[model samples]
Target: MRLRVFEAYRAAYDKSPYAVAFATCFVKGGASDTLAQFKIERAESWDVLRTVKFASFSGLQTGCIQHFFYNVVFTRAFGPQRTMLVAVRKTLAECLGYIPFVYMPNYFMLKSVFNGGSSLSEGLGDYVAEISGIMPNRSFASRVWLLCRSAGPLC
Candidate 1:
C-alpha cells in the first residue's frame, strides 16, 4: 500500500510539479492553521476565512515561488552539488534576498488584501511598518536593511 501510494505521488509530482506542490501546500497550510487555531491560539471555533487565506497563500507562495526558487534559481546559481558551503550560501540567499525582498512583501500584501485593505499601497504600508518597526513610509532599502538587521549577528 505504501509503495503504491509513493509511486502514485511520484508520478503525480513528475507529471506536474507545480500543481502537486500547490495542492500539497494548500492542504498542509490549511491543516497547520487549523491546528494552530485549536492548539496554540485556543480558539473556540474554526476561522474559515483565516484557513482559506493561509491555504491560498501557501499554495501560491510556497507552492509556486518556493518551487521556482529551489528548483530553478537555486539550481542555476548554486548548482546541484550538496555541501556545507552551498548550504550556507543557500540559507543566506533565502534569508537575505528571497525572504526579505520577495516573500515578506508578498505576504504583507496578501495579508492586507485578505484583511480588507482597499489597495496595494495599504499592503506596502503594512510591509514597511512591520519590517522597519517605524513609520509606514520608510524607503525600500531601509525596510530591507531593518528586516536583515533583525536576523541578529548573521547580517
Candidate 2:
C-alpha cells in the first residue's frame, strides 16, 4: 500500500512538482492544526476555519516558495551533486536564508493576520511583543514545551 502510494506520488510529482508540493503542504498544515487543536490546545470542538487558514497559507504561499527555493535556488547553486560538502552547503543555505528570511516572516504574518488584532499597527505590535519576548507568559517556546510534555516523557 505504501509502495503504491509512493509510486502514485512520484508519478504526479514528475508531471507537476509544484502542485504536488502545494497539496502536500496543504494536507500537512490541515493535519498539524487539527492535532494542535484537539490534542495540544485540547479544544472541545473542531475549529474548521482555523484549519482552512493554516492550509491555505501553507499551500498557497509556503509551498510554491519552498518549491522555488529547493528546485531553482538550491539546484542552481549546488548543481546536481550529492556530496558531503554540497549537502552541508545546502543545509547552511537553508538555515541561514530560508528559515530566518522566508519562513519566520511568513509565519509571523499569518499569526498576525489570523490571531492578532485587526489593524496593521496592532499586528506589528504583536509581532514585536512575540519576538522580543515581552509577552513572557505567551511565549512560543512555552507552547512547544507544553506540546512536548503532552506527547510523553520521552519528549
Candidate 3:
C-alpha cells in the first residue's frame, strides 16, 4: 500500500524537471537536518489538520513531506503566515511556479485512494480550488483556477 502511494507520488512529481531539481536540493545538502525539519513540520501540520477535523492518515503520508520542505521552509523565511494550512497553500502556489498544477492534487488523490477508498481522480478538482484560494499569491491562484476550470467535475 505504501509502495503504491509512493509510486503514484513519484510519478506525479517526476513529471516535472523543476520538482526533481528542488527535491535534489532538499535531499543533498543538510540531509539529516532537512529530514528532521520535515518531520517537525509534518507533526505541526498533522496537529493543525487534526484540530480542523481534516485529519487523515493519507493526508499525513502524502502531504507531510511537502508541508515540511515547501511550506515550512518558505513560510519561515518569507511567507505571511505560520499556520499549517496557510503554509500549505503558499507552498502549493510556489511549487506551481516550478511543477505542474496537477501534482499537488494528484498527491491528495493518491491519499484518497489509499485511505478513503476513492478513485485516483475523485474530489481532486475541488481540493485544487480550495488550496488555490488559500494561497497568498494571485498569479499562482489564477493558474490553479485555470487548471480547475479545464478539469471537468469528477464524480
Best candidate, TM-score = 1
Screening candidate 1 with a backbone cut-off below 3 angstroms (N, C-alpha, C), the clashing residue pairs are: none
Off by over 4 Å in 1: 134-155
Show the colliding residue pairs in model 2: none
Instruction: Score candidate 1 by lDDT.
Output: 0.84
* Total colliding residue pairs, candidate 3: 0
Residue 102 displacement in candidate 3 (angstroms): 3.8
- List per-prediction Cα lDDT, in the order shown: 0.84, 0.75, 0.51
TM-score of 2: 0.71
Rank the candidate models, highest lDDT first: 1, 2, 3
Residue-wise C-alpha lDDT for candidate 3, range 108-153, written one tens digit per residue = 6755664564586675755677777777566776777655533221
TM-scores for all candidates: the values are 0.81, 0.71, 0.27
The best candidate by lDDT is 1
RMSD (CA, Å), each prediction:
5.8, 7.3, 16.0
Error of 1 at 126 (Å): 1.6
TM-score of candidate 3 to 2 decimals: 0.27
Stretches of candidate 3 above 4 Å error? 1-94, 98-100, 136-155
